[model samples]
Target: MKPKVIGKCIIEKEEFPDGRIRIKRTTEGITAFELYWHLEQAQEEISKQLMGLLKPDIIKRR
Candidate 1:
């Protein structure tokens, strides 16, 4: 664990073979923050694409 996030960490997953992500709630477990970040980024991109029909804000923001 990084020194900065030693106490604040979690175990999360994304893009499973079953087409689902899973988050673990075990104690003293490893955390996949990288996966979480990518998943969130993907969701945002997808939302922007889906909302593009109603919103043109992303074009300017991006």
Candidate 2:
């Protein structure tokens, strides 16, 4: 299935035939395309970036 927005992040889930499941979560942020439409006839290139708020949290799955 395709990823969908759940809360702040985009989440996707997949199930394997071997009884294993895969889950992924990605940050939903602004894209470069959005800048073009809003800016309209911009001078130079525009970009948006995201940075970690704090220390990264590592998750270990069994």
Candidate 3:
């Protein structure tokens, strides 16, 4: 089963356009990092990171 999303942390680069990293937290206490370079990238990365939080092994690999 997939975990529920609980929170997020986003970091934006002041000097670079579309440069950002986002970290999402799940109800299961898992977190995943995302790298973004554009609007699509930001959306895609958040989705990818949230999916990563669903796997039990993802935390161990960090």
How close is every model to the real structure, measured as TM-score?
0.37, 0.34, 0.28
Residue-level lDDT for 16 in candidate 2: 98
TM-score of 3: 0.28
- Put down candidate 1 lDDT per residue, 1-62, tens digits, no spaces: 45222234556665688788777753443346755777899999999978876567757677
Candidate 1 weakest ten by summed lDDT: 1-10
Across 1-62, the per-residue lDDT of candidate 2 in tens digits comes to 54443336778999999999999978765555665555764433332211232224322231
- What TM-score quantifies how close candidate 2 is to the native fold? 0.34
Model 3, poorest ten-residue lDDT window? 28-37
The CA lDDT of each predicted structure is 0.66, 0.55, 0.56
Candidate 1 residue pairs in clash (backbone atoms < 3 Å): none
CA shift at 52, candidate 2, in angstroms? 40
Best by lDDT: 1
Off by over 4 Å in 1: 1-31, 54-62
